[model samples]
Target: MKPNPISVVTFDLDDTLWAVRPVLLKAEDIVFDWLEEFAPKLTDRFTAKSFMKWRWDIYANYPELAHQISQLRTITVQLALEESGYSTAEAKTLADQAFEIFIEARHQVLPFETAIPMLETLKQHYRLGVLTNGNADIFRLALGQYFEFSFTAEQLNASKPLPEPFLAAQAHAAVNASEIIHIGDSLEHDVIGALDAGLHAIWFNPDDKEISADVTAKYHVNFYQVQCLSDIPAVIDTINKSRLHSRVTSP
Candidate 1:
């Protein structure tokens, strides 16, 4: 039988509601251009790809910094300069400059075409919220109105795949976990994390990647699969109808 209708719907910001790669690429270009112009000494050591690699490596090494992307970017720039033979003071200055350039550039966001319309539809029927590991200020990009609440790992000090952030989102939304539906692209982070927190999850698997054997092996299950934002309303209707039937049949 189908489960209860979701009363609250929380979404992952990056790659789920929007196409983040283009915005990130534009941000990187702006940062690199600034570094090349103002901090030419640091430019030689830091390329965008290498910078991203180093940032991810640092996040992996210091799991505590997982939600601190800004800090990770800053440290990555500093480390790149030091590795390329710059002194500590010089690296620090370059890192600060790079971070400023990146942050200002990142504010120029281009939300996906479907994002606003879909949110408008969902907002009418369900409480809407955001669950992310990114900087909280990201809402300043002009997508804040649709959500009644937004929670990030930085605020909770715990990233996804850990249940804290999801639970935190539930608290912030003032909704029970079972009544919340989470939508995200990452199987490990979104699906597993929401499930761990007892929220219904929907895998936004636009890429058509086969379900992993490991996920299947663990017996993890999601409430639905959505290939596009347009599919959401239908899925919600299905869930609601099933819930109505279950209620009617209960002894």
Candidate 2:
């Protein structure tokens, strides 16, 4: 008559839940079309290379805003427009509209085939949450039903690879690090950062990539990892049973 030891599990949204590349590519295309129609003169001067330069420049100047990708992107567009000969006020207005277009398109993602079917089952066992660096809105996509809370780098002011978000998750659950686990695609951001913050981690390695030299050290010993989304339920069961057994056997 004991409660589950693993009370919470947080997930990364972009590459973990869906393929990010196609969505981003489509979002970029949407933005390009919007710009051509709304600000033809700015589009005439705009190039991908120049857009990247402007974005990186914003990163350089405002390192504190580094984790807030939405703001960074908005400012990038704003600055690029100003440089392309728009008045500052017009630049800001057009930049906001351009970002609105991009963000709407960004949410049109195709979740991995296994993702939704598995979520209801997982939610029965663990209080699930989302922790993402990207700006995808779960509520808009109707994915909020599967999760109890959602955290974003934009809101946290700290992305993955930093301990802040993981620590925040631990605090949100009001539990020790051992009671929470995170799963994501990035070895550096997901596994390493979670472990560094003392939370358990699982690498959702759908691509079947090998762990690079340094990441293989302590992480392999400390956490459960999976190569496919379909494998997650079994992995979580193993972790839950292992934790339960340890607690029962402990003196």
Candidate 3:
């Protein structure tokens, strides 16, 4: 039996394509230093620990702001200033200036060595698209040409583990859910969300942690797992083969 041809392959950016945490940490440091220099009042509210905590607090407080990481950082800086007794207008200006410094210094990304080459290879065989929940301007990162379309939580107004964003990617890819495969690093958001949206999913588990029993059940129902980006092409090939076999077996 021949394998099923996978028409569309969608990916989550951030951790899936690159080592996001280190880049983000460095970016945050750059931002913090800028705040100290130009927005000293705002900087007073954020020690490294408090700044990290504030990020989650802000996310919880403004769920709609999840996809706008950059904007959220600005707002966080502004709010931190206000909390520390600055006037709203003062906070806004300081935060905006600090954020500009952060943005200019934040262009460095640590994409895995295999990521771009893998994309180059995969693009030849399948339609590629991005379904990230991040504010990383993928186009600015020079990855835009590899993808036929890209969707974000901001664009769809829905974040993963929700079906809306996944469906949005499907729409952008112009393919049915079953014909597309979604890949990403988060087991909860990427794997479960894509599965729920009726697409096959691949868990990009670079950390080698075992999926919990609870997650295993979810994974077994609709997804496969891969330890590295390098494994993706083989996984796609296997899926295509299985698809072909099933079709041949059908009446």
Candidate 4:
């Protein structure tokens, strides 16, 4: 039970740090506008609702590509264009261009008031990183400086709430599970994923909703729950201190 010194801190993007729903809604609107002007054949054939359904169908058919949302979206756009009578070459060019615009708008995010400040503070002590299932480009938003590295489900072909990406992060950081802590908003995705991979977890439940992810009693001690950004450091400190004391007192 020796105190495991923390070396790396990993986080979730999207709702954990910013309001992603608005960002995505605006991003979708921007993409829709771009498509109407630049790829009208595709737009004329399908409204936004059906366009979204086509995107969903892409994932449903080829789930092995689940983590690669960017690619899936690009493929969906290309299919829409081709189905609307664009030639193969034209469809490919339009899809790639449209996807570029979509992603550029996607990273345009507004962080929570304390989110960046807390990251700045943590960067002073730990090697911070991001692990996200979404196609968010932190580097595109000038937030890259805060993270030492990022693990995207897009690159791994595996998403979180599953242990592949989390274990991959553990290997990349070259630290034991005890030496790392993951913070994110989803009870199932961040907390359960981290614990399943043998790391400590801090649930960033900002809404303070009742815990519903089914925590069996034995695993409770490995969890830390936080409602506000400023509270994270203290909770992490408490875990470290508890581990140190356990080491000291063990027979």
lDDT of each: 0.79, 0.84, 0.81, 0.85
Give candidate 4's whole-model lDDT: 0.85
TM-scores of all models?
0.86, 0.94, 0.89, 0.94
Model 2 has an lDDT value of: 0.84
Q: Write the residue-wise lDDT of candidate 1 on 1-251 in tens digits.
A: 43566789898888887777787888888887876786666567667677667667766775667677677778777887788677999889888988877777776766778888888898899888888876635567677888878887777777887998788877877767888888998888998888888988888888877887887777445557788887887788787787788878887
| lDDT digits (tens) for residues 1-251 of candidate 2 | 44347779899999998999999988887888788888888778867556656667667887877887888888878888898899999999999999989989999999999998778789988889888888887878877799988888888888998988888888888888878889999988988888899888889987788877676776788877787787787787888888799779777
Clashes of 3: 4
- TM-score for predicted model 1 compared with the true structure: 0.86
The clash tally of candidate 4 reads 0
lDDT tens digits by residue: candidate 3, 36-89? 787676567678668768767767787677667777788887888888788999
C-alpha root-mean-square deviation, each candidate: 2.9, 2.2, 2.6, 1.7
Q: Count of backbone clashes for each model?
A: 0, 0, 4, 0
**On residues 3-107, what C-alpha lDDT tens digit does candidate 4 reach at each position?**
676778899999988889998878888988999999898889989889888777767886767788889888878888999989999999999998888888888
Better by lDDT, candidate 2 or 1: 2
248: Cα error in model 2, Å: 2.0
